[model samples]
Target: MAFGDIVQGSLQDFVNIDRFDTELCVFIHIPKTAGSSLSTELDRMRPPYHNIHRKYFYGDTVTFSRIEDEIAAVIDSGALADARSCSGHFSWTLAAPIRAARPDARAFTFLRDPVKRVISDYRYSRTPTHPTYKETIERFPTIESYIEAPETQDKMARFLMPGDVRTPHEIDTFISTNYAFVGLLEMYPLSFNILSLLLGHDRMPSEHKRKTENTVDNAVDETPRLRAMIAECNQRDTVLYDIVRHKLLTVRDDWRAMREQSRPAA
Candidate 1:
C-alpha cells in the first residue's frame, strides 16, 4: 500500500476509536496548568460519541485508597461499557488500573514552567477561600519554606513519570512512550487546538470561555529570592517543561498539516 494510504487508514482507525470503540481517554492533570478549565470545557466540548464522561480531581482530600475504591466500583459495575473520558490531578499510577478496565485507554497531560506554577500554587493556597489555605499556611509559613518543602520538589517530573526512574532522559522517554499528547501551558491556545484535533473536534474551544479561571495570585509579592528558590527546587520540572515546549514547537505544523489532509473533500 502507498504511504498515503497507510496514513489515511490510521486516521480512519483513530476516528473509529473516537466514534465506536469503548475506550477511555485519561487526562492526567498537572495542577495550576489550566487543567480545571480544560476539565470543565471538555464536558461541554464532548462529542456525542463520548457522552458518559467523568472528571476526578486528586488532592490531599482524595486519597489513593478512595480512588481505588471508586475505580474498583466503576470497573466491577461495568461502567466503562460505553465510551468515556476522565480528567484528574492524579499521578500516572492510576493508568494501570484504568487500562485494566479499558485496555485501549489513551492518556495526555499538560506541563507548565515550574517556577511560575509553584508561585501560582503558593499564592492560591494562601487564599482564604481555598479549601487547603489553612493547611498550606500552616505547613508553609513562608514562600521559602514552601519552595524548600519536599512535596514541592520536581513535582511535575515525579507526577508525570512516577517510580524510581527519574533523569531527564528517562522522563522524556516515558512521556514519548505513554502519553498521546503532552501540552504546554505557555502555548495553551495552540495546545488546545491540537487537543481538539486529537479528540475529533472540528475546532478548539475559545480561550475566553474557561470552565474555571485560574488567575495568578498577583497580590502576593514575588521577590527575586522566592523566584530563585522556586527555580532551584523545581529544576527537574523545568527540564520536563522544556521537553514539552520543544515537542509543541516541533509538531504544530505537522499536526495541522495532517489534520488538513485528513479532512474530507469539499
Candidate 2:
C-alpha cells in the first residue's frame, strides 16, 4: 500500500526524503502520460504549483534548449522556494538547478508501455488537440513513419536520459537512484497509493484532468510488424517498462495477491 510495501527494496535503500522533508517536489512530465491528472490532484492539496511555460511546446526545437535554461534561471533567481512543486516536459537534468537551489527537493515521473504510448502519440499528433498537430501531420502522415522518425525514437528516453546513455539499465539505475518514485501507467493504482503515502496525503483524489487519448477517434492497426518496429525504435523505453513491471509486480507477495484477485476464474 506504500513505498515500503510495494517497491522492491527497503525504504532505507533509497533516500529518506518525502513531502514533509522537501522544500520542492519536482514532477518531470513526459508527453502522453497521466501527468496532467496527477498535477490536478497536486493542486487539490493546496500547494503552490510551478508549471514550466507551455509556449516552448508551440515553438521550434531551437527553443527546447531555452525552457530549462529559463527555469534554471528562475531557480537561480530564488523563485523556487515560493512553489511547492514544478511540473514540465523538461529533461531529468532540469532537476540539477532545483536540487542545487533546494537540496531536499525530490523528483518523480511516470512511464508507459512504449508501443501503446507511441500509438496514442501518433493518433494524438494527427488531431488539433495536440499543440503541434499541424506540424506533426505535415511531417509524418503514417504511424510507421512517425515511429521510425529520429525524434520519435525512444520518446520516453528523450525526457529521461541526459547524455549519450546507451542502455535501459542505465536509465533504471538513474530513476531508482534519483527519483522519489517512478509510476507505471499500467499499474497506476499501486503507483498512486505509493505516491500518496510518500507525500503524506490524508485523502487521495482520483480524477484525471483530461483524457487526451480519448480525443483521437481512429485507432492504429497495431499489426505485428508495427509493434516490432515500435519495440526496436524504443528499446530503452521498452526495457525500462519491463524492468519496472517485474520489480514492482512480480517480486512482491501483495502484488501477486492483487493479481490473483483480478484473475479470471477457470
lDDT of 1 at 236: 82
Judge candidate 2 at residue 181 and give its lDDT: 72
* lDDT digits (tens) for residues 1-266 of candidate 2: 21223354444232234444345777888878777788877665537777775453344541334676778767776667787877887878755777778776777778888888888778877776666667777788778778888888787777876767657667667666666777888777766655665666534447854655544433578899989999988888887777677766643455445446656799
- TM per candidate comes to 0.76, 0.80
Candidate 1 vs. true structure, TM-score:
0.76
- Whole-model lDDT, model 1: 0.66
Off by over 4 Å in 1: 1-22, 47-65, 207-219, 253-266
Model 2: weakest 10-residue lDDT segment is 12-21
Give the whole-model CA lDDT for all candidates, comma-separated.
Answer: 0.66, 0.69
Range of the 10 consecutive residues with the lowest summed lDDT in candidate 1:
1-10
Per-residue lDDT of model 1, residues 1-266, tens digit only: 11112123343443334331234677777777877677766666652222222343457662233555566566676655564676665678855787777777777788888888888777777775465566677788777888888887887877778766567788777777677777777878767766675666656556452222243432457788777878888888888888778766665566567667768899
Evaluate residue 81 in candidate 2 and report its C-alpha lDDT on the 0 to 100 scale: 72
